[model samples]
Target: MSESTKRWGLLRHHDFRQLIVAESISHLGSQITILALPLVAVAVLHAPPFQVALLMTFQYLAFLVVGLPAGALVDRMRRRRVLVAADLGRAVLLGSIPLAWALDWLSMPQLYVVVLLSGVLTVFFDVAYQSYLPHLVREEDLVEGNAKLEAVQNVAMIGGPAVGGLLVRLVGAPIAVLLDALSFLGSALFVGRIRSVEQAAPRPERTRIGQEIMQGLRFVLANPVLRAIALSTAWLNFFSAILESMILLLLARTLGLSAGVIGLLLSLIGLGALAGALSARRVTDRFGQRRMIWVSIVVTAPFGLLLPFAREGWLLWAAMIGWAVTYFGGTVYNIAQVSLRQALTPPNLLGRMNATMRFMVWGTLPLGSLVGGVLGQYLGVRPAMLVGAIGYLFGFVPVVLSPLRRTAPAPVGEVADDLPGSEQPVRK
Candidate 1:
């Protein structure tokens, strides 16, 4: 078989195909919510810049609250069950928004509560989803699997926003959210039909949840490469959150762009990300994974500075181009780093390791959103975005300075035993 065929072979597996379908549907819905949820607050409710930012804060706060514990819980449960349940729960939560709106009872508090609860479910779903993939594909195929998944997500983003924007304009934002709710039901159906059985890891005779959580934490922190990747990713997420919390506000309020136009502009990020996902394997093959990780960020992130200058006419076009390039770099960086993390981890610790890593990386999102809200409310939207755009340039520093620069990518089916501070043997 050709190398290309080998890479694409995972699509032939029945269970993996189901996962792809589920992810495709789920991601398309999520892309709609990504645009519509904030628009609900900003357009429908007349939320101030600070309050609109709080929507993001509420959505991500669950990662910090339950991220580590969810990892331990997932390690003890069936990951597939966790995934299906999370999807169903999200469906119910999101479906409530339109119901409340139809009753003339929709309020900011209800919106906050819905996003917060759904985010909790998301934390579990994401942890299980990442941990579950290894069971369905070969070790060598991890990068291809992750890249395909990322590509599906970006593809959804490319179309979802435009559709969502039109829906928001015509049917209203609350009604647009109902479509997301229905999509989750379809995702749950696909996930439930997956036939592959997960082989449970052996449990210790006497184990504490805290100890398991700590083990995952130690594994990440002790490894120089994991440590640096976590730090760099966290930094990137922090500033990116700030930028996202305000970008809609800038477009809708400052530029006075229509919902349809805002959606089209945002689609550029998805477009660039799709290009990056399609290119990641080739880029890694040519440059090597280590170089690809840092270089992707360093080269493309600087373009984010152009975002602050976005105005009517040519500047808007320049800003959108820069936005797309930045997402392109981020997509490439994520695929390379995530594949490395999955390759380096042992099977027994996969859930916990992913949880710990997410806790560290995604935990910054809420804090950044809160800060952005304050900055936008007090310092002004454009200036706040400038702060975030500037911070993007420095996100690569941790990875560039770490030992990851010197090490080769981990080989398939084997941990990088030669690396300093590799994971310790799991305690029984």
Candidate 2:
């Protein structure tokens, strides 16, 4: 393969192709749910703002509840089995929604139960998914692999919402969820087809699960770069949750926008994210990965301030522009940081490291959702979203001030033991 072909050569691997196909189907399904689930709560159930927001809280609360132990467990099992089981579980859980609705038995409580249980399954899938990649592809291909997957996610983001809007408009939100459930089944089938063999997890050798979890925690905390990335990402997710939890309510109720229009507006974030994912490799090549991490956020996050000013007219377009820009930057930052994380950790620690990071970064989402719900309940949705947009402006501070700014990208297939304050050495 020529250098250019090799740079994008992951597609040549049959297993990698299967992985992306699985992810593509799953991402599209997920994007549909992202719009449909909340709409189900708002439109069908006539849920109040706080209750609508609580849906998000229930969805992400699993990360905090099972995040650490999930990592240890993933490391001890076949990641592919974990992925398939999670996918099947989510399918069954989501499939119940349409069934309940059909039987005229759907309730807010059922929605909450479905979301919460589905989230637990998602937690396991996500940790195993990240940990499974290195086993599937070479170290040098990490960035490319992550970028392609991220791109697939963004593409789904662009199309799924538009499709979801049409589906919701035609069939109502409850039936729309059925597609997502089916997609999970499709994802499971594709994943099952991947032929690469995952070695059996080594025996635990008497190490307790708690100690394993703490070991992952210590590795992340002790490393300056990982620590800063985790902090900044957590901060970003906190505010993002607040913004996202309220956006649908604001557009649907406050601005009086239709579902179709809202879906189009939401797709703008995907447009921006797609652009970022496409450009990440070249951009990182020109600007060092370390510099790009902070630079991306610093340049694009400020646009989020425009979101608070959105109204029914031209101002809404301006707000969407801000939203798109913010997602663009966020996608770039994500690719860079995730690749770095994958490269830095030893293979055995991948599950725990990813879990610990998820625990730190995603744990705040529930809190943010709760806060957004409260703020929207008391202060109104627009004002609550304004607070979130403002918070985005400062999310870059941790990465900006960290040793990561002064560090270079770690060479492929090797750890940077010389990194300042590096405590846990990567096990070869």
Candidate 3:
């Protein structure tokens, strides 16, 4: 390997590369599924706009309500097992859709139920997966490791929307979801094959279960950095949710855009995300992670508002492009934040910490989804979207208002071991 190439984490370790490949393929499936699911509700099921948004809201609910408990479970159990179970469970749940559809037994309500259930499992899989990264690679490698994953996801996000549109045009929406299910199984199989050494753990679960759960919440809430991020994420998600389903609806109904144009625009934005993820490490070092996170949130957030201004042809595409830039910014911001959080957290509490933050930030999603529909119903599409854009501006308020804005990266093994309820950072 070339010296410069070796300096970055491209081909150094087999485990990291395996993770990237597995996650990349899985993300493509995930993105495709997410994109296709909404299209299914709209085109095939003939559901109203509100019902379609409900599908997305149901999926996000797991992160908000169940994230903490799932995290606690992950801390006590094997992370790899959690990932495997989550993957297999999601595969079965998702696969049921096509099966039921083929049997002529599929219904809108059933699709909603499937989405919700699969989302619940994903909450466990995601929290455990993030925590497990520290065990897979060194602290210095965290940003690089996460960057690769983020880059792929960004690529998928771009492609997923476009791919969904085409698949709907070609094979029908129900079948598109199958692609995602298989990807999960693919991820499960690859993860099962990794034979690398895991960090060792001591005896599990001496502390009371309730206490353990609370400890994770306490650490995330009390930590300034995590708290700031949680606040930022919650606001961002809530506002984004507000406009979530409304975008495609507006494009189709109000602006008179073709489905192909919408898909293409979505895919084009991914190019920005790929760029952001590729350069995240250098950017993080230059600006410092904390400031960058807030700056990115604040600056990029207004993209949602631009959507309302979309008129025709160039104008509509312009708005989507604006959103893509911000989406890319948000992607890099998250990579920075995850790396920082993992670096600071003790191994034992990593899962819990991840879950606690996820729950709080993600929990508000349903309300946001509901509000969007109601606003669109009473006020109109553009106004409702404007409100969503305004709300997203709140993401940076907590960060700008806090002392965490200037903090440097915390060293590894500083997992607050001195605290009474602290457990050592759990290893595989």
The TM-score between candidate 3 and the true structure equals 0.93
Report the alpha-carbon TM-score of model 1 versus the true structure.
0.95
2 against 3, candidate with superior TM-score: 2
The estimated TM-scores of all candidates read: 0.95, 0.95, 0.93
Cα lDDT of model 1 by residue, 1-428, tens digit:
99886766778788989999999999999899888988989888999999999999999999999999999899889999999999999999999999998998999999999999999999999999998888788778888889999999999989999999999999999999999999999999999999987766755454788887887887788788889999999999999989889999999999999989988998888999999999998999899888889999999999999998899999998998898999999999999999899878876677888999999999999999999999999999998999999998899999999998987644422443432223334321
Could you give the candidate ranking by TM-score, starting with the highest?
Answer: 1, 2, 3
lDDT of each: 0.89, 0.90, 0.78
Which segments of candidate 2 are over 4 A away from where they belong? Answer: 3-8, 201-204, 409-428
In the range 308-367, model 3's lDDT, one tens digit per residue, is: 778887887788888877787778888987888887887877888888878888787877
Better of 1 and 3 by lDDT: 1
- The count of backbone overlaps in candidate 3 is 6
For model 1, name the residue pairs that clash: none
Task: Give residue 41's error in model 3 in angstroms.
Answer: 0.9
